[model samples]
Target: MSEAGKANKARSGGRSGGRAARRTLRTTRDFRMLPGLTRNIPYCEVMDEAHVERLDNASMNILENVGVHFRDPIALEDWKTAGAKVVGERVFLDRGLVRELIRTIPAEFTYHARNPANNVRLGGPHSIFVPMTGAPFLRDLDNVRRNPMLEDLATFHKLAHMLPALHSTAHHIVEPYDHPISQRHLRITYSSMMHSDKMFMGMTTSPKNAEDVMEMCAILFGEDYLEDHPVTTGNCNGNSPLVWDETMLGAMRAFCRRNQPVLCSPFVLGGANTPASVPAAVAQLNAEALSALAYTQVIRKGCPAIYGHYLSTVSMRSGAPMAGTPEIGLMNFMIGQMARHYGVPWRTSGSLGGAKTFDAQAGYESASTLSAVIHAGANYIWHAAGWNEAGMHCSIAKFVVDAVQCAMAHRLGEGPKWDDFDQALSAVPDVGPGGHYLGHPHTQENFQSAFFMPELFDNNSIEQWVADGEKEITERALNHARNLLSEYQQPMLDVARDEALRDYIARREREIPAASELNQSY
Candidate 1:
């Protein structure tokens, strides 16, 4: 045989053997969800120390001069008692008091999940990807956009449970229009608890709903256990332009009093809610978040809280909200710096897009937002999956693809792996000049872990792709999501506890007035 032919024959056995090993590895892979991401990469900082200090001073000025309105009478009283100057509802805070109150927020805390394996630490260098929440519509696997039902919401929980990338199946992936508005929170909480054991958020629509969610959680994880261990979180969105209403304040009180974490997120549409300039908008947002963080301390000294905000730019032409704008990315970096400066963990929106369909626009926008969130070192990344159409709908295909992107991001955030550096370097000499490492021992052994193999993305020869129906990413993602749903197993729950949760949900459903009896605006 020729020298080349001899070489080919010699490498054939190892190549085939390696292929078989990889196939087996893929087939028998365990899909347990990642507990969370611990970032080894340094955070991306947009603002230098001087810029950050300038923003800080600006925020303090806003808080001290213009002041924030504590529309809730209870909040006004709390701020007044906490030494803030209250003139009616508007409370002026001294920078010293803001810093003092913020000192109590723990830099990091363990968020307990029902399944111990899924418990995640939020804050510090840790990060958790939470599915998008509060979407009123859903684009189903069949690609039909419609108002979601309770079954749809439960299905999303199941998918999130099966997706190894997602850390939490956030409450209310999509609103269940078929259910009564008042009773929906109970069902949503029940669905989240039963479908996935991961840590999640609770309803903060009203104080009563927040209390009900807390009660349900207490049943799931004993009240005594909950007092010390922070479980679910409450998202208390502020009324932008420096205002905190009773609805949000009441809910914040409920969560803080129980020692649970609350995400004091301000929902801001730049140019409409705050100044058009990014710095001015961030300054205002910082003040709003600081005030809420301070309120958490007032609710109960040393309670857990997250500095959070959902920031978006407004289009000057249409007045519609824009996602994944450069301004938004800059804001994320600035916010992360400010949060670290305050020594508090922060949350931000991720995978956000304004596209109506899962097309190039959607992919570009989502990628931009997701990259920004990860780079900024956001601790709790909400809307990390399935956010589309300016947050109007959650797309199943987009959700699957976004989760895979998150897994990729998690791997990136972990930085470089040096465990097998020596072994990897050894392969270079084994394959001399003009040689490839395809059949090298080191290459075969590390191939799986060496690179991120996206489950949804197709990377194959044109002929192979053609043989497999030439599927688009959206279609392939939909098929993958269907398979995940089929394989999803409801997390184990004690029968007694499950019954208690159900019973509580039932009782609340009965006590709460039906949607028809009340206003439909909610």
Candidate 2:
């Protein structure tokens, strides 16, 4: 564990007492994937030999026969030169070519944070969690939902930095609706850099936004330093059923060419954007993922790219996409298998749901999906906290709740430690003949670091909980979030560098026209 983990034990509040007793526990260095640690165990597998072979063959057939639609002419030319069959916008890749290209990508690489001690590696056995992103509405604990202001966007970044569970965050934590669409990315990108020392996602709204993201990174890391160290990633979604749009491709060109990563994801909803059957959806998801992955290599061989899959079932009655569904978890397992097959980093959804509020439905949905994410040995998880309402809203209550869950998942995924088990067993003699072990020396020595201590869950006695206002979990979460935000301190950066970043954003905002082809999403 990083020293940051120790900070969690320094203080905790939001309980009913004058102030809750903060857990004074030491860090679980052996069993926790903290901000800068690496995981080293073999990932648990879900598919057998035949199942893996079948899925791979099916995805290969889709790419070679049905083909993926590449909208950008430059991309089509790149594929053509790589010996792919090109008919209009459709690019048919040979299976061997894809397999060979994939091998060029490194299985593991470090993503540096502004704080050198906080650098995290991708494509390892560990999991990295980021906060909810791209939600247009912000929902407070009071159930007040509205288009978020620019100040609200900055506050979310500050909160994310204070939360130890979050290693990085997506760029637009919530859309800053108070600003004009054209200027929104500028401020969003600037806020993340200024507020957090951890790594984060780059802007994907436009090719120009991609340029600004790179410029800001250069200002922080310096030009030559960025050549070997990647600091951020972008989630580039392919239009389902084998299609890559112009904006996504352009953004990929910008990020991949600079030796940064783009999570090549398929925004698939089973039976809506993909086939209803899990296997069929897996095949389509794999095919769509291949197209995006292949394009990244085509642009720059060995550029880090993650195999991303976001699968969900559709509500038959309303045609709305449903997250945290049984089918989605199944897809997540298969996606991990395929990523392992290709030897690349894998990305999956987290704490995702379609609930309209932070109630039973939301908790059940996020819990089920999060469990699969841990079991699948996923490497990167986005929307790990605060996502709700079919990705339309990010809730403050749920963010706090999910942070607790994320921390628990990391410790759980680490499995149990067997070190010095003999000492624990030695205490069995002291507890023989029905004598309690609670007062034993071994128990006394191990109690604080033996388990995962939650940040917001109440473990107090019933009487004590009642005395402390009998607050609900969500109510406690709201207060915990407020306390975290209140305690946040901006990460240190050189004063000149900060000014350079601001000047760059200001110039880009003035230079870019108010209206452009790719401003629709913002």
Highest lDDT, which number?
Answer: 1
Candidate 2 wrong stretches, greater than 4 Å: 1-33, 36-44, 515-522
- Per-residue lDDT of candidate 1, residues 128-204 (tens digit): 99999999999999999999999999989998888888999899999998888888889999999999988888999
Pairs of colliding residues, candidate 1: none
Clash totals for all candidate models: 0, 0
Model 1 reaches what TM-score against the true structure?
0.96
lDDT (0 to 1) per candidate: 0.91, 0.81
lDDT value, residue 169 of candidate 2: 57
Q: Candidate 2's residue-wise lDDT over 298-324, tens digit each?
A: 899988889886667899999998877
Q: Estimate the TM-score of every prediction.
A: 0.96, 0.92
Model 1: CA > 4 A from native = 1-21, 516-522
